[model samples]
Target chain A: MKSLDFFVYLFIMAGVTYLIRVLPFVIFKGKITNTFVKSFLFYVPYAVLGAMTFPAILFSTGNYAASAAGLAVACVLAFREKSLLTVAIFACAAALIVNLIAMAIQ
Target chain B: MKYFKKGLHDGIPIALGYVSVSFTFGLQAAGYGMYWWQAVLISLTNLTSAGQFAGLDIMVRGAGFWIEMACAQLTINLRYSLMSLSLSQKADKSLRGVHRWITGFGITDEIFAVAMGSNKDVSRHYMYGLILLPIIGWTLGTLLGAVAGQVLPEVIRNSLGIAIYGMFLAIIIPPSKKNHAVLKVVIIAALMSCVFKWLPLLSNVSSGFVIIICTVAAAAVGAVFFPVKEDSQ
Candidate 1:
């Protein structure tokens, strides 16, 4: 893509992103009292975040074994209530070590 | 000020994670022959993960895909709309139109996790504080990686990719552990997501649609079957 075209696309992307995020804030100025809507919205965070994480994450570390090791370590650490940064760093390190050892064996 | 300071403290992990995640983005953009400044500019303007990456993919496919790119971006980012809608209820009512509007701009997954997870209502000052570090780190990391492309070893780069997903898992696990409803919702959503990935017929569905379906479906199931029961413990 040309530089100008790229910029235009960026502008559009930003606009669309802004639109999705701002519309709710602008429109819903009060609490939502309907029990169904309330419960549905309450579950949104965990569902969305959980869906975003797994399966995709398992493939992120390039090698399946390494990704699994990293994922397992991260889960164990997170379940222990490790801080976010700690869990991420330790997981990444675990993946790295696993990847390196796998390569060394080859 | 108190909320703002706490927002900053809460944002630290996210900032660190963004720096790593966007670093890969920088690498990819640079690999595509993008100018370093252009990569930084994109990062500055678009504070989204999947959208920016999907947009980059469409850009690389080279021609006759602008419309496809836009649609792809819209779909990938559609999750943010859901997140913002959820956040709307948590925002402080004292916030003005401008504050609310600005708050919407930085509603990435990590930020949303921190904001929604907060015990108190999210305020404008706190939102700004929460957004500041991640934006700076995201832009700076992109610039550093794009300009200094190829400096990092492949091993390190690939390994750091785990940090982003690890961050995501970290965000959800605590809440799910605390609440069985949250646990069920997460498990159901994950199962649905896995079905989308492994089932050939369902695997044909685009990732964006898969996420949309799983999120809404799991949440709706939770709402119907297991509404929150309030009691003083």
Candidate 2:
């Protein structure tokens, strides 16, 4: 795509994201008193990340098996309270190994 | 200066994590044949993973869907609004005026977490220090990944695809391990996402909207059924 064309989309992404992040901080000076709103905000990040990760991760690699291996490794490490970098590196390493083994088998 | 130095100290892990995750994003952007600089620009401007990836898809394929792209970004990034609000309460007098806007611009998930974890009030200087390395790490990682992606072996490039999702799992999983409410929310959201992916009629929903629906539904369920205690923070 042309640089100009791509910038249009980039602008939209950045503009909207910055708006979301900035508006609340600038407008809401005091604490949010609503309980439901607060709880929803509290839980929404986990929900969004969870929805984005799964099913998507399963299809991220060359094949399902390799991706599954990656997912398994990631889940275990994450559940064990591993650092984000460690979980990420180990997951990719696991997927690569599975892909390499599959290639050898073929 | 002490607060600034402390912020930098606390930001080290987040910076390291962003490098690895954004490396995957850069690789993917390269796989899409983006110019290395263009990928870096996206990282520099947005500083988000899921939103950028989703936006890239629309930019490449669905050229005329700017509104869809905007909605997708808003939905995917809506949590930042919450994070920003939460941080606003912690803001000190130094966080007023244009400083608030600048500070808000840097409120990524990890940044917000580190800022909130601080027992002291958040200052503009502390935010500046906290945001500096991660932004640098994210953009540098993207530049390197995009450039290397052009010459790297296909297998390695493809295998790196899972790294971003791995980071996502890392972010959400540990919290879930500690809180049953969070665990249920994660499971419900994941299951809803799967249903939207596989079920006959729902399969036709656009990926962006699917995420929007799953997030709202799952989060609403969490709020209504398991409202967090007022003092829980």
Candidate 3:
């Protein structure tokens, strides 16, 4: 893509993303009162992160067994209330180890 | 300054996760023949992971797809609106005016999650401090990946790909363990996500739309079936 075209596309992408993020702060300056709305908003973070993680994480490592191992390790650590950095590091390490084992088997 | 420093400290894990994820993105952008600076620019301006990848795909497809790019970003990032709305409830006086705009620009999924998980209301300085290292890590990782031009072993690269999702799990799982409502929402969302991914016709929907549909459905289920106390939220 030409430099001009890149800038245009980049601006469009950035502009749209920014607007989605900023609009709520603009429109809802005061606290919301509705029970259903509050409940829904309260759950949004977990639901979004949950949906984003599964299925996608399965394919992330490109090796199903390794990815599964990573997911399992992560779940175990997280369920144990491990810190985020510790869980993440262990998960990656699990995937790397599983991948290496699979390579040796192959 | 206390909150600012606390925010910076809390941001360390997030910054570490971003570096690995953005490095993969940088490699992809380089593969498409983008300059290192170009990849860095995208990471700087748009801190979104899935949105940036989708936008980069559309950009490479052609300049005529600016409209498509916008649509994709809007759909993929619509969750941020929900997150921002939720966060507005927790915002203190400091997160107002120009500060809102700056913080909003930095509201990636991880940042929002981290901010929401904090013990108290968010302030502008806290948000600023929270986002600082991750932004630099994201952009710097992209620059390193793009400039290095494919030297990493595939196994290590693939292993690192799971890092961000691991972080995501770390964020949600503890909360779910504490709250049955959160657990239900997470389960519902994950099952729906699987349906969207593996079902024949549904699998054809773009990832951005899938995420929106799954999140809204799951969150609505939680809202209706397990309404949280207004004060608890």
Candidate 4:
């Protein structure tokens, strides 16, 4: 992209991004009355993250063994309520180890 | 000054997470035919993982324009609106307009979660900390990844690409362990995603669309079936 075009694109993109974040607060100030709506909103982040993370650990690369190993490690760590850093490291380590072992066998 | 200090303290882990995630983005961009600087520039301007991923998809396809960029970014970042709204309630009652503006810029998922989850009213200083710390981490990660792309071994970089998914699992699994509702939502989402990916008619949909559909469907189901007990809200 041209320098001017790129900058202009960045400006517009930033503006729109800021608006998306800022508008809800400005418009909905003090108006979140419905209990179900509030509850749903409260849970949306966890729900959204869960949805993104699920198949990621189970079906990555269409390889069942590697993905299952990763999921198993993650579940074990999570069940222990390990720190986020520890859990992340262990899960990735599990996947990498599985892949490397598979390669060695081949 | 206080805000700056607070940002540093709360931002450390976030910064760490950003570095790890953005490094993968850097490596991917390099692999996908972007110049090193281009990858860094995207990280600097966007500073969002999902938005950057979508932007890359559009850029690689050569089908996106400024308008599409705007729409794609807005759609991916819609969750921030809710985060910020919840944050506004958590913020100090006496906060001025300027503080709101400055703090709003830092309202990321991790930062917002940390701030909202805090027991005390979130101070402007801490909010400032939330913003600056992650930016530093994210920016540095992008720069390092861009530079490392040419130097790092392929095996190492490939392994790092899987780290983001690992982080995602880290975030999901713990919450699900304690909360049965969360566990159900995750299971339902996985089943739906598998169906969409496996079914002949829907197998061709993009990953982004799969995420969107699964999230909305799972959340709607959760809302209906496990309506938050009346007193929690």
Candidate 5:
């Protein structure tokens, strides 16, 4: 793409992003009534974030082994209510080690 | 001035998170044939992971305007709308036009979570802290990654690339442990996503579509089954 085209695209994107983020606040102004909708909205972030994270961790390389190991480590740490940084470090370490072993065996 | 300090403190963790993640994006962009400057520019302008990845896809394919817009609006960022809505509720009651206006600029998932979790009043000072620190971290990380890409070995880059996913797993696993309902949602969403990836019939669908479907389906199911009590909010 040309420089101008890319700039235009970026501008449009930034505008659309801002609009999606800003519009509901301006329009709704405190009129959310449906219980189900409110409840649904409440869980969207967690669900969405989960959906985003899982496939990347598990299947990024088209295999389940490393991802599974990572998940296991993450679950243990998380169950203990470990800090976010600690859990992240341990999970990555577990995944990396599993991946290396898998690579070696192959 | 106060907003600036708040943005600083609130932004520090975010900045730490951003540097590591954006570093990978920078390396990827460079590996994909983008110039270092281009990678830096993308991080500077769009400071979002999925959106930048989608944008890279569009760039690689030389997609049209509509495709670019669709990919951006659909795939990477649709969640921000939810974040912003939740944020407005938590925003300081006394916040007025411009402060409220500028505050939304810093509303990334991590920042929003931290800011909303704060019990204190959401002053402009705090909001500024929430914003600036992450921007610095994200932008500088990208720049550093672009430079590092030339010198770093492939293995190191590959290993570091997993940091964000690790961060993500950290975020999810804790809450899921306490809330079976959240756990169910995570499992359902993951299984559905796997189905989308493995099933030949569904393989043709785009990543953006997968995100939309999985999010809606999982959230809807969770809403029906887990319904938050009336008094909990």
Candidate 6:
């Protein structure tokens, strides 16, 4: 990509992403009254993160079994409310072992 | 100053997680023949994992792929609009437009989760502190990973790929454990994502739009089924 073209794409990417976030802060100055709208916004984070995570995490590793192992470890750790780093490290370790086993099997 | 200290303290784990994932991203950029500086610029300007990965493909494909770059970016980053919308409810009105502009630009998935989950209403300085370390970790990781190109073993890199998803799980699961409604919404959204991935027509849609549709629909269902007390939300 030409230097100018690359910079243009970066501008668009940055501009679009920033606009998406800033619009809400600019628009909703008053208290939202509608129950459903309130409820919808309340649930948005969970829904968004969930939709982003599930099915996606399962396919993250090269092997299905390894990915599943990682996910299972994460679930159990997070269920126990372990700290984020602990959950991440153990999950990665679990996946690494499972991936090695899968490799051995292959 | 207190919240800035608190924000710095809270951001540590998130910064740690970003290092691994952005390291992977940086390695991929190097694999695409990006200079270390270019990869650093991408991480600095974009700050989005999914959007940057998609944009990097467009960069490598050709200059004519700018349309693909634009579409991929908007679709993937659209979730931030929803995240910021929710966060707008929690943020203090004292936050000026400039602070919103600064904070708004850095609202990644993990940052939004931590901010929204904070005990106090988010403040300007708090956001500055909260987003600070993660941005540094993200930019530094890319620079290191790009410069250290092809150094790590393939096995270790693949293992690190699981770390970010684990971080995502860590964010969602604790809340779900205490709140049954959150658990339900999470389950529904995940199931719907599976449907979107598998079902004929919907499966054809890009992953980004699939996320948007599934999130809105699932949250709507939660809104109907488990409406929070207006005051509580």
Against the true structure, whose TM-score is highest?
3
Task: Give lDDT: candidate 6, residue A67.
Answer: 89
Which is better, 2 or 6, measured by DockQ?
6
Tell me the number of clashing residue pairs for each predicted model. Answer: 0, 0, 0, 2, 9, 0
TM-score of chain B of each: 0.92, 0.73, 0.95, 0.74, 0.78, 0.93
How far out, in Å, is residue B109 in model 3? 1.0
Per-candidate local distance difference test: 0.84, 0.83, 0.89, 0.68, 0.69, 0.84
**Fnat per model, in the order shown:** 0.75, 0.80, 0.84, 0.41, 0.43, 0.80
Cα lDDT of model 3 by residue, B85-179, tens digit: 88898899989988888788888889899899887899988999999988998988788788985777888888988888999999999989889
| Candidate ranking (DockQ, best to worst) | 3, 6, 1, 2, 4, 5
Candidate 5 Cα errors over 4 Å, as ranges: A25-28, A31-33, A60-66, A98-106, B1-13, B60-67, B70-75, B94-96, B113-127
Worst 10 residues of 4 chain B by lDDT: B154-163
Runs in model 1 deviating more than 4 A are B61-66, B229-233
In the range B56-146, model 4's lDDT, one tens digit per residue, is 7667755438788878877777777766776665567544476676567667667776665455777777777667868877877888877
Show the colliding residue pairs in model 4: B3-B125, B7-B129
Which scores better on lDDT, 3 or 4?
3
Pairs that collide in candidate 5 are B2-B125, B3-B124, B3-B125, B6-B126, B6-B129, B7-B128, B7-B129, B7-B130, B8-B129
Cα RMSD for candidates in order: 2.0, 3.7, 1.3, 3.5, 3.4, 1.9
Give interface RMSD, every candidate, in order. 1.9, 3.1, 1.1, 3.1, 2.9, 1.6
DockQ per candidate: 0.69, 0.60, 0.82, 0.48, 0.47, 0.72
Give model 5's docking category: acceptable
Error of 4 at B47 (Å): 1.3
Tens digits of per-residue lDDT, candidate 3, A5-99, equal: 99998888888888999989767889888899989988888999999998899998879999999999999999998888899999999999999
lDDT of 5 by residue, B1-233 (tens): 76667557656656766887788788778777777887887777666777777777677665476665755665567777777776665566555566666667667767765665455646667777678878888988888887876565444444444555555665666677777888898888888888888899997877766767887899899889888777464
| Candidate closest to the true structure, highest DockQ | 3
Q: Candidate 5: TM of chain A?
A: 0.76
Interface RMSD measured for model 3: 1.1
